[model samples]
Target: MLDQLCHILLLVVVSILYHVTFFLPPSWVSVLRISVLLLCAAKPVSVMFTELFGRFRPMPGEGTEGAGKVIGYLERLILVILMVVGEYGVIGWIIAAKTFARSRQLADSQAFCEYFLVGTLLSILSSISLYLVLYRW
Candidate 1:
């Protein structure tokens, strides 16, 4: 409970700082924006899952939690990059690939399906939201 609160607080602080990057030098803006985006996609999203679904335990033959975290980080980063480059159509392919990869597990367990769906949606939404906030502000 307390840990979740801390994560939420940290996310809020980073979001506030994200806005401040606009005041920085133009050369630093891109780097800082990417850095902040990655930061938001990482721990905060994991914390969000924890809060929403409780602890996630992968079924047998599934990858470890750390691997899932890394994958989520990479997934969100890639989505953000795609958005920045205005490749919105490609986003569907990425989501489709992910869903296909997890198809067996998603079909096997109801809980896993819900977790994957919510996590994927949250990740995608967060990436889009972050991009809009940073670039459109």
Candidate 2:
């Protein structure tokens, strides 16, 4: 719990720093913005995801706790980077790959399917939205 709080605080600091460093070069600004936005979105977006999909709960031994959060963070990081670089095709591949990677878990439970789908979709949507708003390039 404390670790999570620290992680959140760090992200918030980075976000503030990203906004304040407008005098920096555009490339540095973009990278900082991406880092802050992705980190900042990870927890809140996930909380919203759980609230929005409250009907579906994870099954026992179905998924790891922090693992999902870390995976989501990395996923969004990659997605935002890809978006910035305009590799739209690879983004589709990433989604497909994630889906395939979790095929067994997704296939095992209907609730898990809904949970995974909604979470993945929310992650993608949030990444795109953040990129549209924060990214200068």
Candidate 3:
């Protein structure tokens, strides 16, 4: 139980840092840890979705099936939101939530722009990949 809680806490931290930094937690150790967390989060969600919807089983077997559908769709939608949120989230995490060009909150302007650009590019690429992954079979 405690171990699970710690894992959850680590996920929250990693996700939080994901937006703030492209290759978050720069150290090799931190990067590896974060990568593991991301893999952990993503794998379960995808597997559970596939299992519940196994072989076109959109709602899965039973038990928490209904709840899973609701939560799964909601979660997929939230993932899209988070993708966009990372746009300003990174900037805000560094600057202020009210950050803008006019705000003059460009502390790490160069680094921020670089990271933001890469993030945006990766976002588009990932969206396309996500579409193909979900629909193309």
Q: Which residue pairs overlap in candidate 1's backbone?
A: none
lDDT score of model 3? 0.43
lDDT digits (tens) for residues 1-137 of candidate 2: 78669877886787678677877888887688766676657666766666777567675574566677678878888888898788978999999999999899889888778878888998999988888877654
lDDT of 3 by residue, 38-131 (tens): 3443444445444543464322232453453344343343444444344524432422322343134235455444433443343334443453
Report the number of the highest-TM-score candidate.
1
Give the candidates in order of lDDT, highest first: 1, 2, 3
lDDT of 1 by residue, 21-129 (tens): 7788987877877777777767777677667766664464656656766778889988988887899999999999989988998898987888788779989888898
Q: Provide the global lDDT of candidate 1 against the true structure.
A: 0.79
Instruction: Give residue 31's lDDT in candidate 3 (0 to 100).
Output: 52
What number of clashing residue pairs does each candidate have, in the order they appear? Answer: 0, 0, 2
Q: In the order shown, what is each candidate's alpha-carbon RMSD?
A: 3.6, 3.6, 19.1
